[model samples]
Target: MHHTTPPNTQLPFAQACENNQAPILAVLQTALQSSRHVLEIGSGTGQHSVYFAPRLPQLTWQTSDLTDNHPGIQAWHAAQTAPNLRAPLEFDLATSAWPTPADQPGFDAVFTSNTCHIVAWPLVQRMFELVGTHLPASGVFAIYGPFNYGGRFTSDSNQAFDAWLRQRDARSGLRDFEAVVALAKLHGMQLQRDEAMPANNRTLVFRKSLSQ
Candidate 1:
């Protein structure tokens, strides 16, 4: 059945996405060599999934987000002809139980881009907890967004963006890199790679620790 479009306007399709997709894929190509099922959280305009799914045909891309965002995601999904791209699912990481059924083996990898800063800190922590629960011990979780390192903004633009975000919503702002890493550790995840992306953003890759 056809889905209605979401209310949010089309994002600018950031040049950063264009510039970084290849590099990000290069890393994923190696990191996800054995991974087949990938769950993408908070797929805003669905550009990354559309771009990556066709390139990695062996990997099934399952995109998800809050129900309100499903329509836009469907619109983007409709444009993709890749057989590996699945329909967008309704998911909210803050919730205790995932919307997906338990029978489904957890995702081989969980990916998200440009979302952490938009949500609150507790939600971010909860997201890691959910990721830890849904992913296998050796599975990967990758997040891409602007972030502050050592409690300082990495760039002036990011600082301005942080201010803008806070002005819009007091709790919305760029997160601290160290804090995220520490939280991930608490959930039995280890920081694997922290790559600097174009436009002052970063891609942080974490692996769920097998030791529990």
Candidate 2:
């Protein structure tokens, strides 16, 4: 997908999003090929939505974030005119209500990035709970962020990052991969891939059981 820069005035921009969007799309190109609709959690600047929606034309992208991030997301959404992409919705994992429709099947895929380590641990758990509750059977859930494996930091950089996170908020820090997997399992999803992304981040793909 060719991503154009938003005019300097309106929306916010995250270099990290610009840096990582290509790699994330490389994976989602295949992972989300069959998906018709996707719910993006924590769409920081809506850069990913505009960048991805045009490329993956088959899927309708639904953007969501807390109320505070709406203007930037909306601005980005307005700047781009991908019919497949929806406007930003005010949805927070911990506070806002889930936008589930009783008559329709849930999202075909759920995507979130750089959120787990930022929110409190309980919110992460709650996020998974919402994923399990709203994702359709066999639906994909992709989460991208730095994560520890076997309760050990993957790199010294990640170690320092963790320390910085704790210093900022004692309740927030990188999550252990194993613990996260176990939590996903309890919620009826199974890990399908733990992709090593650029920098120290990972994009974990989990799929719900079709029988569930």
Candidate 3:
């Protein structure tokens, strides 16, 4: 999910992971406090997975991404000693079926960071569909990334970041917070909270309706 892919590196690294891990964890400690298992979409370099799993010892962290990113994820996983950390799963919301680990009934929570703005809009919707349908009732869904509020950028930096993302991939850009909330609602998720993150990013937390 981290955009900057280091070149010619034995173990891929994303500087943003180091910068935001603590803040993200602060939020997760409470948001996912009751979660038993978490499915991480777009694990990227797996830096976040490694850093977070050991800290959140209560839940099993499952890292996933497209197959090409597996090597980097494996590299990071290899260096970690967290028994709760699972290996990378080959996940592509656009193609691959939703993963259901044989060891568990299904994941109770879902977490993804810096991914919605990187993929096309349809894929983003597909991700929501999968999560909405597969996640158990009263599950958690937390996504971290830059988001526009009421069709307006939250800050000048986020505005510039949106422009850069579109320039890089016309199909990819900051998603509207309202639109995302609406989408989640359609999938039986209710907004729980929105936390401000560094660099104009936001972490949106939603809880699946108990009746879902």
Clashing residue pairs for model 1: none
lDDT of 2 by residue, 103-130 (tens): 3356889999899999999999999998
Candidate 1: 10-residue stretch with minimal lDDT: 1-10
lDDT of each: 0.81, 0.87, 0.91
Candidate 2 residue pairs that clash? none
lDDT of 1 by residue, 60-127 (tens): 88888788777766766776668888777877767736546454556879888877898888888888
- Which has the higher lDDT value, candidate number 2 or candidate number 3? 3
Model 3 Cα lDDT, one tens digit per residue, 6-122? 687578888888899999999999999999999999999899999999999999999999999998899888877699999988899789999988886589999999999999999
lDDT of 2: 0.87
- TM for every model, in the order presented, reads 0.88, 0.92, 0.95
The list of candidate 2 runs beyond 4 A from truth reads 1-7, 101-105
Better of 1 and 2 by TM-score: 2
Error of 3 at 25 (Å): 0.4
TM-score of 3: 0.95
Ranking by TM-score: 3, 2, 1
